[model samples]
Target: MQTTISLEIQRYRPEQESEPVYQSYEVPLRKDWVILDALNYIKDNLDGSLSYRWSCRMGVCGSCGMMANGTPVLTCATFLETYAPGPIRVEPLINFPVIRDLIIDMSEFITKLKQMKPWIVREEEQPLSDGEYLQTPDQLTEYKQYSMCINCMLCYAACPIVGLEPGFLGPAAIALAQRYNFDNRDQGKKQRTEILKEDNGIYECTFVGECSIVCPKSVDPAGAIQRYKVAAAAEWWKSLLLPWGNR
Candidate 1:
């Protein structure tokens, strides 16, 4: 007998429905199939009207993030065999306005990302004649952990802080900022510090750690935020003690 599992997917179509609703579909339960495979089956065989985002089924693109059984996870990495002989609840990431089925408005996230200035900012560009800036392995190791972020937004969905304060900078963005902050070649820490010191910045986070728990790349955004807090505090003290010195 062929085995199958039920998937209860949340749907929201502005043209057809004013509110979101659950729609169930059955797909073969295969040992090697991830959740993306089942969703593909549904899109190809069962329903053509379904809408979702997915790329690089190998889990590098980070486009297929969704709420699976009440937890934010990458569908490309989640296997169906893990939840056999039953139904799985799949929904779009929470704490964001739904665009359609399994798609949410990421405009806010993108705006926050830009606010962080997650890039190398040198005061004066080294002339091409100077050649590319070089760094030792130890320097690379300083920010390597935070560099694994794929911008999947799973952290935002899992973060209670984001749910409470929509303006908060959130986790992944801060972590990526920290990545550049830790880079030896970068020189924009002071600029980023002022922005992150705002009322709705890292101070708003209550440290629930759900963002770190849901990160597929092990970026540990919670840890990054804490590190930034400590760094920001030290800078504050330095300004208090040495007001005459350049901050």
Candidate 2:
């Protein structure tokens, strides 16, 4: 017997709709199909109006993230059989404003990422003899786990605080910042901390930890936020004692 799957998608078309709404579709499914494949089926066969983002269907691109069956799962990684024998709910990742359908306005997330200066800052000029900055395996291990972030923003979507506060730096960006901060080769932690102390910096997170739970790449953004908080708190205390501490 052939199986038909029910897909309930959340639709938002900013050009025409005042609010987003859910639209359901019955799709013919193969047992091995992934959620993204089902979505493509809808787009290819049923509804051309459905909108979402996807690149590198293999899941490395991190563009296909969405809330599937109520949890934030990369659509490419979430197989249909997991939510099968029944209907499934597909919606845009939460916390950001929906641009249209499952494609949210990631501008907010991207802006914060750039604002964090998520890169290594060289403190000293490279010496001719020293060559490139060397990272020992242990040093690499210290932050290698965090560096796996694909910038999928699932952590941001899962974070309720980010949902409540649009200005918050959110998860993925903070994790990326933490990645550089923890790197032994990095020396700009102090300068970056200045910006981190702003209104939407580390203080914005209430530590609910939903970001870590929903992260698809296993990047522990909550832990990174906590570690950054420790550093920030120390810096704050140091500022109280020394006027130039944060400067």
Query: Which one is best on lDDT?
Result: 1
With a 3 Å backbone cut-off (N, CA, C), the pairs that clash in candidate 1 are: none
lDDT of 1: 0.93
Per residue, candidate 2 scores C-alpha lDDT tens digits across 1-247 of 6488889999888788898888999987687789999999999999998889998988689999999877898999888888777689999988777888999888877888888777888788688797888888999998887899998888877888887888888888888888888899888787777888778889889899988988878888999999988888987788789987536
Q: Give the runs in model 2 whose Cα sits over 4 Å from its true position.
A: 127-130, 241-247
- Candidate 2 is scored at a TM of 0.91
Residue 200 lDDT (model 1)? 81
- After best superposition, candidate 2 residue 90: deviation in angstroms? 1.1
Model 1 steric clash total = 0
Candidate 1 residue lDDT tens string, 7-121:
9999999999999999999999998999999999999999999999998998789899999999999999999988877699999999989999999889999999999898899
Considering only N, C-alpha and C atoms within 3 Å, which residue pairs clash in candidate 2?
none
Q: Could you tell me which 10 consecutive residues in candidate 1 have the lowest summed lDDT?
A: 197-206
TM-score on alpha carbons, each prediction: 0.98, 0.91
